[model samples]
Target chain A: MTRRIFGVRTLGLLGLGLLLVGSYFGLFVAPAERYMGQVQRIMYVHVPCAWIAMVCYTAAFVFAVIGLWNGKPRWDARTTGAIEVGAVLNALLLVQGSIWARATWGVWWDWDVRLTTSLVMLLLFAGVLALRSFVDDSDRRATWTAVATIVAFVDVPLVYFCVRWWRSLHQTQSTPETVSPAMVLPLRLNAIAILLIAIWLIAQRAKLERERLRKEQVDEPARVTAGLEVTDA
Target chain B: MSQERKRRRLLAVVALLIAGGVMAYLAFGGIGENLVYYWSPTELREAGPRAFGASVRLGGLVEPGSIDRQADGLTMRFAVTDGEASVPVVAETVPPAMFREGIGVVVEGTMLRDGHFQTQRLMVKHDNQYRAPEDFKPEDMKELMKSLQFEETGT
Candidate 1:
């Protein structure tokens, strides 16, 4: 266990190093955008964060599916960890996006389809987290959250396609064809950095959850025995 | 697998499929209802009376030399045209810095009974094209700062 913790810490440090290097290139090396100027640099962090958030949500969805199919506590723990991390990243995406919008769009927010759908996705997953906390029974909590996660994931595709489906102020997805090679390097690097950090955090969180489950298992017999004594008396 | 377990798995699959189908239907239905919040001036004109009093968005290029800012600085009148048709718009807010003539814009509001569109919000539509201007004049930067300040104070 100590070795595993050390490994995770090492991975996190590596991610931090990559993030600093990526930011250096993005801020100092990349050419300034013609129209947006310095504000465009925010894309280096904002876009990567958004991408990782989506990836995390997709991971949560996969774990939820496995948990439901097998009724496994391990999968449930993984799903919970992913959802928590994904929600935090999604929130950061919104904040960074709003700052960008203020500089470029001249407004902090708008009820555009893309923005609205993204907000709905965040709220839906947040509701799942809240629901899990409200349920007292461990098995019931796991099952309920797994089902909710699946249902909530239906919004993910809608969020991705909202800009294309409806007239939106938000720009469409940027790809190699749309972005210059010089700009793409930092974007890719930061994406890798964030992805590595997310993986490490999720792994640590899942381990903690598993430990709690293990302790519960150890205490289950004692709890039952105490209940039996009270009933007998 | 036991017969009971097999039956349970089949039931779960069927249930998931039905739920997915229902969700897809509802999502598509919502999108269809608000598909095009704004219509081009030509579309709005074709809708005629149906467009009147109904809250909708009108999108088009702003007509050059048609903007009239009232003395109050809050009330403004302009014309939005899609080349095929034009609509007169009256808005009660200072326009954005990019809200100049020939630029594309989408205004949300409703067509009044008096043959004018009353705008609740005005959004300037910019394309993905990015290029630095040849010159970064200090005066232009000052003008931009002034406009941004005006927006902050006015709103």
Candidate 2:
């Protein structure tokens, strides 16, 4: 318990540090674009959110595969937890991307492959959650979810390569050499920070789910006996 | 013991497969459109004068009086300046209507043999508020100063 508490506190401090550095570098250190003015600052939030959401989905898919192969209850729980978080982050990404697009592209949405694939990912997560709720047996849920997770992960590559494969206007990947030193440094730091925070959130939520399941297990027999007694009465 | 180890090994292999898929995508995915680059006029100039026909973006202030309206009046020619250097841009399309002298503009095209911009695209590069005439209103114009909210005066 103490170790768990320590882990959460450590992640919090680390996240705070990264946030401060990211904001400083992105806002103050980086030179403003010659054309876009300060609106370019939107890149700081938009890029990281998209990157982290992709990573989260990837992580969840890995765990889903592990759960399927090894039939491990822990991995199953982690898979579900990660997917839940990834879904929320993916939703935020869609919203933020739309906002940035409206500001930059003059339209709130587009039919581009990247946006479509991201929406597909969001729907995939929703589907997985729906499957989990309807399935009564834990093993069945894990098995089906593992299959669904693997299939949906194929969309990540589709999304990443969408611009290249199609004639979309979205720009290419963010590379260290392509960006100003000031901009790249903060972006790299924020990427790491966001990844860590995402992992921490998944871990925390998994732990809570584990504790809840354990409590339910402990109460199950008592509840069954109480029901039997009432029926007899 | 053997069965459990076999299962663990299977999971490990699956993880490796997923990793390999992501790596392959990173290496070769989206080859096109990834080349889209946004540069300031200052940086474009700093690149030390590309070959006359090299495609590049010349971003800067549209120099006053440099605008030459054609007889047709729909087409216009203007120069973008970064205070240090300037590039003349010839735009055939009707300017964004509100597009005028002294505002920020980004002209996308290649540098010509004569050092002018053979612009294929001309963008007004508006701030948060400046909507096009389709949604333009007097009230929206009033909010432009507040919405832009920049400290640097374009003087």
Candidate 3:
């Protein structure tokens, strides 16, 4: 357990170091945007958070599929951890998006397709996490969450394609043809840094979940024995 | 597994499928109805009375020399053009700082009966280029760094 903690800590520290370096380059080295000026620096963090959140959700979807197929507790633990981290990052994405919107769009929130669909995705995953907590039986919880995650994942593609399919206020996807090389460097670096952090967080969370499961298993026999004694008395 | 367990599993699977189908239908139906939240001037013209008084977003470039600030500084009028068609816009709020002539913009409002768009929200669509201002020189960066350092030192 200590060794696992040490590994996660080292990964977290590496992520932090990369984040600091990426922030320095993003803030001080990258040129200001022609229109948004310094406010555009937020994109370095915002885009990364959004991407990592989506990636985490996608990982959770895969874990859900695996858990359902194999009925493995480890896969279920991974799905839960990924969903928690993804939801946190999703909330951060919304907040950061709101800030950027206020600066660029002259409004904090809009009912545009892109924004609305992303919110729906976040809410759906949040519902899955809530449902997981409400159920007590581990196997039942795993089965239900796996099913919910699969259903919620339908929104992922919608969120990605919303800008293309509808008349959205939000800008379309950023690509090499759109962004400059200097800007891409910081964006890429920050994305890598955030991805590392997300991996470390998910790993630590999954480990904690496994430890809890172990404790529960250890107590199950004692609990049954206690119940038997009570019934006998 | 017992026969009862198998029956329950089958029922659960069937329920999930039905739920997924219903959700997909509702989601797609909503998207279809709201697909075109905004219309270009050409599309608006084609829609004609159908678009009148309905809340919609209009996106295009701001025509140069067409911006007119009303008696109140907050209210402004401008014409949005897509190079093929133009729509006059009257907005109640101040335009964003990036709002300017020839720049891309998306205005959300209702189309009045008199062929004008009444907007309460204005958004400036900036291009993807991240470059310093034309006037910004490399030497200015040195001074900027120095000032930043001085501020950090509270000197």
Candidate 4:
């Protein structure tokens, strides 16, 4: 137990340190964009959040598949954790994108293909969370959650590729050829930092879920016995 | 407890207003009209009369020296060009912060009967490229490395 706690503590500290360093470099050390001016600095946090959000969803997808294949309670807990964390980041990504859009694109929001697909992705995952809550039976909930997650995974790839496949007002993905190496450093640092933080959060959330499952197991027999007593009386 | 509940209610109202206001300001009109995102000058030219008076986003570079801000200030005219074709535009809205000649832009409006694209919303489109204004070339990085090496040797 102490070892597990230590792991989380270490992850949080390391992630915090890297995030501070990355933001410092992004805000001050890195060169401000030419046409975009200082507003482009938002990309450091925004892109990382977007990338990690998708990473969380992808992990959730893999875990859901595993849970479905083997009907494991642990896999269900992990899938739940990943989806919840992914949704939070996805919401943050939209807000950050909106702010960047207002600064650079001259609008708070636009229904461009990429932007629309990302919003749909958030909704689809949020639906999975809601579905999990409505169902009372644990095994049935796990099965349904797994199926819903796999269906939602379809939108993740679309969000990433829509800008390339369609005529979007949002620009295509930036690359080393397009962005300066100096700009790339802080962006990469922030991505790693945020990813570490996400892993820590998912671990904690999954642990909580497992503990809840254990508590429910301990209560199941007593509740059933009480129901029988009332029926007999 | 009553005060806490009242505050919660007030917070909910404020949050709703902020979200609705933002959506109304930016999205209500601008979003659905831009489903196609943008049409190039070539496409607009090909569409011809079919494009007239229909809502569309005409996108291309703002041709250098084509900007004409009427003395009235509210009325500005510019030409959008995609090399092979060019479309003259008269915009009522102020250009975006980064808007300038030679920059890519998407203007939402309609093709007028008078052979001009009349736009109410003018937006700038930035490329996926980013660069420092000071132009830090790769040679500068090599020079920095060489200077660092010299310092190490002297130490």
Candidate 5:
């Protein structure tokens, strides 16, 4: 328990450190936009949320695959925990994107390619979580969830490319080459910070889940005995 | 050498293969083409000479007195000029609600196989400025400024 707490605390500090650096440059040092003025500041938060959400879902899918293959309780818990965190951040990205769009594009919502693809991803993961609630057998649940995760992972790149494939008015990516050097640093830092924060959230959630499962193991004699008997046999 | 461990390893490899296959196809195989087009009037003009007969964006200020509304005001032909280069555009569709003769506009179409500019969509560029309702009244604004004890600090 002490080790687990220490692990989570360490991750929290790393996340905070990254965020502090990100904000320092993003808010204070970066130059304002030539056209949009101060409203360009929204990119620091909106873009980072989207990038981190994708990273979280990718991590969740990896853990889901691990859990299904090995039938491990720890991996299963981590997969589910990451999925929950990813879903929250996905929703955050959608809201922030909408706000940014309204300020820049003069419209709150449009059935554009990127937006549609993101909504599809959100619904697919929501279905994954809902599917979890319907299953009682741990192994079967993990396997099915892993399959669903793999299928859903296919949509991440699709969402990224939706705007290009179709005629949409949304802006293209701000890359190192495209953006000014001063803007690039803060944008990159904010993205890294968001990714770290996502990992920290997943670690904390996974730890809590481990503790819950640990308690169940201690309280259920039948499960413990069955495990011991199987090992001995 | 345990049977369970071997099975787990095999399953993991299979899962990895599936993931690799899907990601490879999506990322490198032209399966994902979602990219949003963002362009300024300057960029459009720069691309004009080289973009012969190809579809591209044209954005600029709508030339005043150049808008010709058809029988239905919805279908209009206008000329967008960057003060140096101008293109005559025919809007096959209705113009956006905010579109006016003087504001900035962006049209998506090709500089025809000929030289005529034909557009499939017309979008009005939105400016970023907000003034409070109280500030809408000039007299009230002056009184509010006087009450705040503010004076001009610069020429």
Candidate 6:
């Protein structure tokens, strides 16, 4: 089992390396934005966190579907892992945006549609995680988490598209085509670095979840009579 | 087992129906009526009397040379333009440091019958396009460093 999961260590090392280089490029190598000047460097961390947070939620959504379909504890564990990391990144994204907003928008917060939906998205998923803790039975907990995750995942797309679909103070998405190559380089580097880091976090979190599931099965022998003891674990 | 399967199918169908209903609602008129975050100067102008004295957030670029700082220092007047149309604005508060001519901005306030939008909240709107200053001069950097050093040593 340790051998199987050892790949994540490599992921962590590479992610850290890229993050350092990417931050250097964003902060020093890349020129300050014409209008925003030094303040625009916040994009290096903010955009990646926003992207990876959505990516993690989308992963959780996929794992959730599989968990519900197969009623498998492995999928449930993976779903939880993605959701937990996603929520942390989502929270970080909000903080980064607030700091940026204070510098650029003059307000730390606003009730604009994009901002509002992102907040709601965080609440919905955080609520799902809260719901998971209240249930004790592993099977029931897995089912409820999967179900709640599917519901919460609905807000992810809304948060991403609201800026484009509506008139928003938050600018629309910045693609490689829209931005200069100098700016895009750091942004892309940070994006890939954050994605790899997110994957490693999910893997570690899921392993912990699987171990707890194994313990539960061992402690409650009668519950394991159905031969549904996690085969991977 | 067949009874259990039947119940599951029914639940699935109900969920799908709810999802479809939501999609329909969003498609019909929801985006236009409910989801508008802010209106541009053009839209606000077209709104006409409907816009009068009603609270709204108007978004647009600040027209160059339109800013007029009142004698009282608490009031500022400017024209917010969307290229095609412009809306005169009187803001009763300080604009953000980033606020400048040609920068996009959003102001929340009420529109008066006399065509001036009165605002207490002015927010700078930034674009996604990031570029280093093309016309940045080397002399400016030297001057900036001198200024920084002057501030630090207090000489």
- TM per prediction: 0.80, 0.60, 0.83, 0.82, 0.64, 0.87
Write the residue-wise lDDT of candidate 6 on B1-155 in tens digits.
Answer: 35533543454345445545654555454554565656778888889899997889987778879999999988999998776689999999877778887777889999999889999998887766666788443333233222212111111
Q: List the residue pairs that clash in candidate 2.
A: A172-B34
Error of 2 at B102 (Å): 18
| Candidate 5 residue pairs in clash (backbone atoms < 3 Å) | A161-B34, A162-B34, A163-B34, A163-B35, A164-B34, A164-B35, A165-B33
CAPRI level of candidate 3: incorrect
What fraction of the genuine interface contacts, i.e. the true contacts, does candidate 2 reproduce? 0.04
Query: In candidate 6, what are the lDDT values of residues A1-233, reduced to their tens digit?
Result: 66767788689779989999999999999988887889999999999999999999999988877776666689989999999999999999999999999888988999977789889988988998899889878877887787777767767877887665566778778777656678988998999999999999999999888888889888987776363557664
Clashing pairs in 3: none
Number of clashes recorded per candidate: 2, 1, 0, 0, 7, 0
> Each candidate: what lDDT?
0.74, 0.64, 0.76, 0.78, 0.66, 0.79
Using TM-score, rank the candidates from best to worst: 6, 3, 4, 1, 5, 2
What DockQ do you compute for every candidate structure?
Answer: 0.17, 0.05, 0.21, 0.20, 0.09, 0.28
Rank candidates by DockQ, best first.
Answer: 6, 3, 4, 1, 5, 2
The TM-score each candidate achieves on chain A is 0.91, 0.88, 0.92, 0.93, 0.88, 0.96
Which sections of candidate 1 miss by over 4 Å? A222-233, B1-15, B22-34, B63-78, B98-102, B129-155
lDDT of candidate 5 at residue A115, scale 0 to 100 = 81
State the displacement of the C-alpha of residue B71, model 5, in Å, after optimal TM-score superposition: 19
**In candidate 3, which residue ranges exceed 4 Å CA deviation?**
A222-233, B1-34, B127-129, B134-155
Interface RMSD, candidate 3? 12.4
lDDT of 5 by residue, A41-145 (tens): 777777888888888888888897777666666776788788888899899889987876666555566655678879888999898889977875554566667
Native contacts, share recovered per candidate? 0.16, 0.04, 0.39, 0.48, 0.14, 0.56
Top candidate by TM-score: 6
Per-residue lDDT tens digits for candidate 3, residues A114-166, read: 79988998999999989998987776777788888878877877788666555
Superposed model 6: Cα runs more than 4 Å off: B1-30, B71-73, B135-155
- Write model 5 residue lDDT over B1-155, tens digit each, in one string: 25644665666667667877876765566533333243334445567666666776665667778989899765778887655567778887765445565556667777764556788766554332222222232323233222211111111
